[model samples]
Target: MITAADYEQLFAHAPCGYLITDEKWLITAANATFLAWTGYTSDDVVGTFLARMMPMGDRLLHTTRSVPQMQLTGTVSEVSLEIVDASGKPRAALLTATRSVNHDGGVEHRVIIFSAHERRRYELELVSARRRAEESEARSVRAEAGLQHLALHDSLTSLPNRAGLALILERGLTGRAPGASIAVLFVDLDHFKSVNDSLGHNAGDELLTVVAQRLSSTLSSAGTVARLAGDEFVVVEHVGSATDATVLAERLLEMVNRPLEIEGLEVVCSASIGIALADDESSEPEKLLRWADIAMYRAKARGRNTWEVHDPSEVDPAVNRMRLLGELRHGIEGGQLRVHYQPRMTIATSVISGVEALVRWEHPTRGLLQPAEFIDLAEESGLIRELGAWVLDAAVQQGAQWSRLGDGNAPVSIAVNLSARQLADPQLACMVQASLTRYGFDPSLLTLEITETALMENPVMARKVLTTLKALGVGLAIDDFGTGYASLTYLKEFPIDELKIDRSFVSGLGTSDGDCAIVSSCIQLAHAVGIRAVAEGVETDYQRSTLLTMGCDLAQGFHYSRPLAPELLEDWITAQPPSVASGRAAGPGPAHAEPDDDVEMLAAV
Candidate 1:
């Protein structure tokens, strides 16, 4: 309904720029809006080519495609192009064009262009934000992966740790086919502490790292190797049999024993391995680890650089021993272990010379158990040190109590046995001194009985410990003397007060002439060295007579009395005849009417 002039005004002042081009694509007319948008006047734009307003790329695109497309369709909508203004400033724009025939029947194009600067800026910002988000997500993923790696791997060696080993073992067991076996090898380095002490911690770490690499490479096809803290590693594998595990362990040992160069020094190392096997899914990860640990200790006991497989048949005894080991801790704290006194008599006088404190475990379910039943287990389980310390304390306290009862005169001395482990402990002398101080007991009143084998194990350390103990005024006796490889030089070197002939030799007294001669020589040797001789296992008058004739100074056996509890010992001591109690030598005659009464009488003396 608008007039021609109003329509023309509307077209000239439109929000978008408008232009009319001829069939040759030259600009025939440009609206005021179009000229203003381009920073151009009608006189400058009219009769110019429309494509000249565009950048070279957009102009080529328009000439090649948009013109042909518009010719077929009569219109092109939303054609994006870049244009340069009259001032040579670039701008993004969207254009729409329509084709029309003028009165002379010539082709002309009407084009509308819109500025898109803010829209382009918004789109670029959106793309930048999306890219930043993707980068942040990637970083988070990498960080999470790093954290997981740190959690499961040893920082020093990059090997999986205990937790990772458990997980691997669990997964391996779970995924194993039925009747297929899963095995774990517990590896422990031997004498690793010596390396640490001799070199330094850094060298030790380097050695461990090299060992770990060797193990990993050796077992690459067979299993996974993991570190279980210092000098301990584990291997998880799916093996066929005990033999397979043993073979693998031997291979690993050979590889490990190969000389390693650490910090320019050639170091040789050895490892002991314990293997545990499971055939089915019912096997527990932790239990398998424990079995491997036990077997590893057994391997260590046999001598290091060896391997042992956990046998199912022997599991009960091993498990029971472990259980007893646990109970032993409770026993020590709960007073289940009692110290029984076995009296040692002066063979010349039949007087109570001293009492050997023997530990007996009054186990709740098993009843009374002797030292022979559990001592080896204790030594193997590392409980011997604790047991030895407890016995030391108890014996010292009892000796003190007896000294209190004796009014400081003729205090009954107590002898306690020490295990090889206890003797090897550097603090043995300190512990002994502490016990003596705690009970206010004279060190001379305490005798520590160590086996000859224990002394011979490391004579240098033994000499040092023995000398320290001797300096504290305590008596040291070598128990079971003839059984070990003790040379006369060793006997002369050690500050020994007594040599107790092993019961094995004394058991054959009077029956075996060779035994008789050995006992005689031991007695003479003891006297020659100015040390007292003690004959153990004297059960008959004939044995006692022979020992006394051989000049043995002390005798202890069932012939005198069995080991007795404290209260019974008190009663037995109170009932002895004064003649025997006053150090009068008893004749080696036939057995008395009441051997128990004789024992009681002997204890009283």
Candidate 2:
């Protein structure tokens, strides 16, 4: 076990690659294991420098740094280097070296080499994994930021949306300094539908994007601009007073009015702005937004491209209008709306030919209310269609009653006014036919009166609707004629049975020649088309006489009587002179017609 041959065999066949280097750093000896691992024979590595096995950079480091460190410490453990094999391929290795004094007093290095390929590969994988994790974390942060941006901004314009506007307004109102006033301007583009209809939606979107950019530029650092859905934008800023709001609104209007180039087309647009202000911390966000919305509508009503401030004193009107609208709906459902009939008389005969059915609301507190007080509100609130339907049903029922009670010659036809919304309703013809059928009334006894402006709103659709109504044997009359933009050619196109001249022109009768000419021409035009002409607002006897002389087919106004209840109308008709009831023209009688002064005529039936 202690033989010299055994020791020599152990050194030649060690577990690690064993090598010996002289003081000059040349390999003096290499074990069989080292030669085999490096694909080199012992003879090839015995006289070669150990640095020769490394890459040039590693070779320099081993020569200069490793050698000196090992000399000072007498050892260099686990020095990493690249070794060249017999085939000239570099391989990773960890070398442990020890310096010792040989018999000649020269320093020699004893080295043990280990393959480091797996260790190097593991380190590289760890570095790559760390890089991937960092990239993933960065991507996640960016994605979260992008989602937040999208939630608050309009995708098309990149402007803040309604929610974003609310948040900004909330913060402004909350953090505002004492005595500071914040103004919120609600802006709605005027006639934006025309642009969308004419230029296509893609162009409309482009226009909206450009509008957002322009608004942002114009209000830079002055306020926050937000898009509140479809051609509506809002601006929030601190203002000094109402005058400041007005000035700012004017500036916004000017900015919006500038021509925009979108999709290679020049477009012009305008906006109506409504401004609401908060001077104190007590202001609520919802209430401010609502006030701005109401004011915007007021601006629209005043004609577009204008600004209106919400006045606290005038708030009752909008409130009252809404209250009246609710009451109207209630009245219709509860049968509180009474249909009063005003007799229409033939001008030549002075006899009642038909009656115009007018709806009267006997308010529980304010007494009887006229159509002028509520009809416009009803139309604006989208309640006119329902009101129109109720009126049609009531008029048709009354006409049926008249048919049942009257002789063959008695006037039984009824005229009911239709609002523009009713005229535009696709179900209007069907509703009329259903009412006529339900009441068993002849269609000839029902005349639907539409204003000239209503028909002109959508002429093509109006023509189709009118033609459909005419086919149902129901009469159609143009109410308040000559007050709209209807030309003679346009008039001739409608299948009308009568024209009720607008009271504006009739009020000027016997006073203004221009008014008289308009009235005369309207009557003549009606006659030329074989349709009856009815003169409205005939108050003075002279006006009635003049209309009779001008050959107006029919007339109705206070001259005959104010609108009367059904029972009172029957009594009034019976009390008329036999000659007048017989429809014979009266020849210069009293200078003034008797006014019906009865206020408490009938209770709710």
Candidate 3:
């Protein structure tokens, strides 16, 4: 007869305090009673290492004694320890803990804290147990029920954990009307790691707490919402059809995608959802969770911030993802990687200002694969570091070769991308220095293009790494500028040389007045900061002309030349490009006299 409200009250007002921690001994959740006793708020402790809450001696005791005991036996007997209060005072308490594995494949522990003096009270109570049989029995029953409630609940969000979600799903399935069914929607927050990486774990926890509150409040009356683990949550509902569940899924995505401010930073994290419906045979909780998980991954793969419904007729992408990941590893090491260059034309002179090295995978069977196809794979598999290193080495070698060619018309520089993972590497500067020295490439001609997302993820670290790279006399560009919620403060502080306006705004040029304004502002912003403005994705004469008039310093897109193989790019360079704005050719090459046709084909498209 106990309801969720009853369990909440029980946990909040329990006679003893409680704390939960993940495998790493990081506090994940604490009950109100514990927070009150420790003079700390949930926010003060959650996402913080548990040892930090204790004094030096107690910390050592917990780490050396209690944690090992719990790990060996799944439980630790009451151990006397001193927990530090918010005021820097230590409070003596007895700790008893139990550890278990959650459905998400993570280990968690529940610790019940009791006052040290309570041990004496307990012995006294036992001495009078015969006289207070009824009282003791009632208390024992309540304590047992409290354990069940805590066991099934998530410490951080105070929502039903995985086990709790399974129980809810089971009840929904059995309690559904004869013709109705239960639906499970798996919601995974996108780019959450970036938030954590950039804003720190505290901010990530705050964001997760806010998100959990929103989802739970929105569905309080309709269905049950539970935290599955980390950034994943589940919503279970009783529905008549799949359409009903899917429609709800869309609304949930909107809720999750709305911009949020954690602490002082504004963040926008979208959710990719997967919905699964229960049938007569597949209505079990486990089956639905499995299917929904697979479908959620499908939503992510199809461009995140969307939803996907489980379709048995379709192939599960998990297996293919694994196979492709293996192939990509082979591609990088087995010589299937190719570096193509797209020319960057100076708007004023129409000269090939530089070339951005674009990586391609000449898969043994998949033909030529673009970055869009496997960049995420490489990123997720921790292979981006390896892949990026290879690209840097190859691009540097090629740039050095061209520099030696003495083709005064060849690109004056080459730009290479740095993934967030690569940027995070403490040794990134060293690696770049080694590569440049090995190739004997001019540091000035080796520009590094870092995405706004990557830079913003950890600006402090990015700045540190960038300062070192900048010291090497290489150009640093903020790639995909204006696409992320970047602070102008950091932009001004970061040691950057250029801002590459994202292609989206350029694509809308001459059509969307808003886009035109944004592009102009970006160019002006870059110029104001004494940095060149580069426009990406310019595909038409109109787009080109608008940017040129806007005083865009440089541009690269299909209007001039598509990204071509090294040899093809060399040919394009030798073909001589015309002064795009004046329709006059300048370089000493074969197409030096080629008149401007429809639009300036700087080289060959």
Candidate 4:
């Protein structure tokens, strides 16, 4: 194979170039593709060493002693080279080379190269396409993962939500093998609302994220931890003993209680833990969660920062909640609920301007009940939508009755308080319109009162509702103003007709100078905004005097009259002087009070 005749044929007319060298990396053999690729013919390339074709850095690698060693090792896969093309432009390629064998069974030490133009281009295109596909797949994966994460997580804290925890509990309870059990520990942060109220929701969210991380870190080896809305979290320990779960809960509480540096402020909150056993025999995930919830409430009741195991025999709060919801539903439908009107008096004249319609529940066996007893229960159970509708209708109907009963121009405006839930309700506008039409009462005579917190909960939505009500010619008042997180902000956003100073501030108006200043400022703020200021729960003559002196527009409390039935209200209004009735002769509306506090109280129902 090393014959001169063979060499001549290989160089002149052979399918490939051929050459031999003594243990040195001297050129060897090259095919026509290589010649065309490098713009060199046999005369210029045949005896030239491999170093001339290589870059300076690789030139040493193709020296005198390297060719034989490479031949001994056989072919190498995918080796890179930088060679100049016919145009002297740099080209990249992957190559494989093998040593040629001779008839004498000795290594001829010849080299052969297959030009990698098409193969290299194909490989590079494949690599590029693979990279693109990987990037696209990575983006798709990330987006889907983000959506899935959002679906199961709280938007505020990026922690798993109640739905996620339910799934985890289900899997933990059902996926376990025979004899395996799961312990679900429900955790609630103590006084978290105070933190939210005092530090704002942003700080509250930061605290929640920190608390979530701490809970996660605490259960790193124990089980999975998930947030279940608000200040509630759940820890599920699969195949764990009760004692292990209890220890995990204790550690979790400890971790949660650790001070958190949120926005450069140090804050701490204790956690209450409720533990429930979920053995393989359990049928429902809710049962386990219910047990844990019960235990958590028990922990909270026992002074918080503690853990408690679920007690099966005790009355379940879940059942009570369900019962209360049912009662609320029935109470609205069965006419077991009634609206009692409390007269609002003018601060100077003690004359009644309007009545605030308060709801009372007449439980079949529980006698008459204040709204505080069941209104929150209704809100918590999401029955406020229906209950609130009923109250609105009742108040409107009563106002209509008062309008029908009183002389013309004496339409008694009825002010009904609305919860945040009711104001944010999408149907609130329609409901008000429907109630107004149903009772054939003038919308202008129905005053809808909402707390300042209501506006902050969803300002844009609440504004829309208030605007709709205003367009309907109904009066909208911000109830419990100056006692919420964003009273000024609310007043700026919503078109309010009145500002009801919260009872907390009104209770100390005369005694506390700070209270007086606050009341004075509030009245000024309200009037400056073209809204009337009303004082609620003005129980003392001094409070009345102070509010009147401050130019408060309206005042209401037992100092005028407690919430009374329609009959008593009519009789009381008729007892006013005839000239006052003549002053009320605007026809079809209630009489306006010039502000007084000597109105007698009705006996407590």
The reply for model 4, stretches above 4 Å from the true place, is: 1-184, 190-213, 216-231, 236-251, 263-267, 276-286, 298-309, 407-411, 425-427, 487-493, 510-514, 574-605
- List, residue by residue over 1-605, the lDDT tens digit for candidate 2: 49989977887988778999987779899888888888998788989887778778445655657778886898887667778888888888887788999889988988888777544665687899999999999999999999988999888888889888878888988888899898888999999887887789998888788778777776648589899899989888888888988998998888889997876778899988888898774478777877888899999989999999987556645677778888888988888777887777767657666666688887777888887878778888888888888888887787777678854233466667778888788888899889998989877656778889888878889989999998998778888898777887877899987788999999999889999999999988888887778888899899999998888877888998988888888877778888766542222211122221111111111
Q: Model 2 misses residue 232 by how many Å?
A: 3.9
Reference-based lDDT, each prediction: 0.80, 0.79, 0.81, 0.72
At residue 295, what lDDT does model 1 achieve? Answer: 88
* TM-score (all chains, Cα) for each model: 0.53, 0.68, 0.65, 0.60
Per-residue lDDT of candidate 4, residues 1-605 (tens digit): 49988866565554332335334446645556567767877677767766566665445455433444475575444456666555767666554555656677655455444346666566688999999999999999999999989888888767668887777766666667888878888899999998888789998988888888887776657478787778888887764588878887878878887887776878888989999887655547788888899999889889999999997778898788788778868878898987676767656556566666677888897789897788778777788877877777777776777667756323366666777887777788888889899989877667778888777777788788889878988777787778666656667778887777888889987568888888889888987777778888988888888888788877889887778777776666677676544433432121133322112111111
Which stretches in model 1 have alpha-carbon errors above 4 Å? 1-79, 82-134, 174-180, 220-222, 261-266, 281-284, 316-322, 329-335, 342-356, 365-367, 370-605
Which of the two, 3 or 4, has more lDDT? 3
- Candidate 3's residue-wise lDDT over 403-483, tens digit each? 787654455466678888999998899999999999887787677888998887778888999999999988788888998
lDDT of 3: 0.81
Window of ten residues with lowest summed lDDT in model 2:
596-605
Collision count for each candidate, in order: 1, 0, 1, 22
Which ranges of candidate 3 are over 4 A from the true structure? 1-127, 131-144, 167-181, 187-224, 237-273, 296-308, 408-412, 485-489, 577-605
Most TM-score-accurate candidate:
2
| Cα-based lDDT at residue 466, candidate 3 | 94
User: Could you tell me the lDDT of residue 546 within candidate 4?
Assistant: 82
